[model samples]
Target: MNLALLFGEDFVSAEQAVLTGRRLAHLKSVLKVAEGSVVPVGLVNGDIGTGHVLQLTDTQATLQVELPEPPPSPLPLTMVLAMPRPKMFRRVLQTCATLGVKDIWLINSYKVEKSFWQTPWLSEENLRENMVLGLEQARDTLMPRVHIRKLFKPFVEDELPALLKNTHALVAHPGTGTPCPVHINAPATLCIGPEGGFIPYEVEKLVEAGCEAVHLGRRILRVETAVPVLVSRLFDACS
Candidate 1:
């Protein structure tokens, strides 16, 4: 963890906060902080700053915090993703957060397994935990929002059009003729598919909803690898 992320519950007063659990372990083991040591800290959805350790112990640490600097600007991108395999979902969530993607929609695709949605990682607590890790890694405090949509057709037909409004919309398909645009540096909505890619009918629906089908060359990448590659390609700020 690069920055210790503080939640509302961590605060005892306006300028004081307490750390425990994983963060305490990190302080003791990884950061090796002492009573007078100052560490980087940030409040969730708030600002980035530093915390001066006032007290340290095996179980908890008390710190005096000052938050004056705002977090990094969030990417003006809305990510519409096919539900990935349960094993890879956590990593993808972290990647999205680290890349500064503030809005994420996890929708169903033809190739997505129904069981993927059953993963515990999708739970609110687990989701927050993974996103927190990502935020800490990036030294960012603004939390990303994740929207779940299990029905593909309804999402595409009823919701996606509105979501794509005033944004450059594209779907990343493997064999599409158009290369994914680079450095657009503007608001965009990007759709990515599951392991085998979206079925033709699903792609057609997304196309009808306003997304231009685009590809990332001939090389096939796993969802985890493709997400960062596509985000970096689309936004120079991320690179």
Candidate 2:
């Protein structure tokens, strides 16, 4: 896992415990780590450490370990996106994690098909599967929290402010006041609309909510691609 690599430790060990989805497959088909092998280890949110391969058998693999330091500071931005199509959602989640975004708020929108909401991909197990894949890709141990808001206005006008108290906020809209800033300096919460895009009323409410309307370009970018592209661009600006 990249988080382990990023932290320089294995995620599981003796005394304390952790669960791994692919441990069996990893031991068998993936790493083929043998007994007595020293694998770097760390806890998801705790500390980076080392896990000694105590035993490796078909039943299971156990690790003897040592804990290390905590994980690094994460990206300062939180993304607010209109829930996209099923296939694109997986990519978006993975991209966000790969880029160190740990807080994602996926909400419903007018352009979002009603049928899309019922997808099995939103199930807890499926959501975690995608999130873990993203974490594994990033080599980051910290898992970003994902939230869903079905009703748009209430989430925007009510709960959003408290959630965004300390962060700068921006909403990506086409034909906005100014092109999206090349890079943003402070911590921010960015909201991006669904493919067909946010209607005038939605943009107005976001503006009233204190979000600066920023456009990435003259043309619109699909949500899945736009989310990562915008986040990466902002990461560079802030870094």
Cα-based TM-score, every candidate: 0.98, 0.85
Candidate 2 lDDT over residue span 193-237, tens digit each: 999888889888888888889888777788877877787777674
> What's the distance in Å from true for residue 67, model 1?
0.8
> How accurate locally, in lDDT, is each candidate?
0.95, 0.74
lDDT of 1 at 114: 88
Residue pairs clashing in model 1 are none
Candidate 1 residues 43-136, lDDT tens each? 9999999999999988899999999999999999999999999879999999999989999999999899989999999999999999999999
Error of 1 at 174 (Å): 0.8
Query: Listing every candidate in turn, what is its Cα RMSD in Å to the true structure after a full C-alpha superposition?
Result: 1.0, 3.5
Q: Over 4 Å off in model 1, which ranges?
A: none
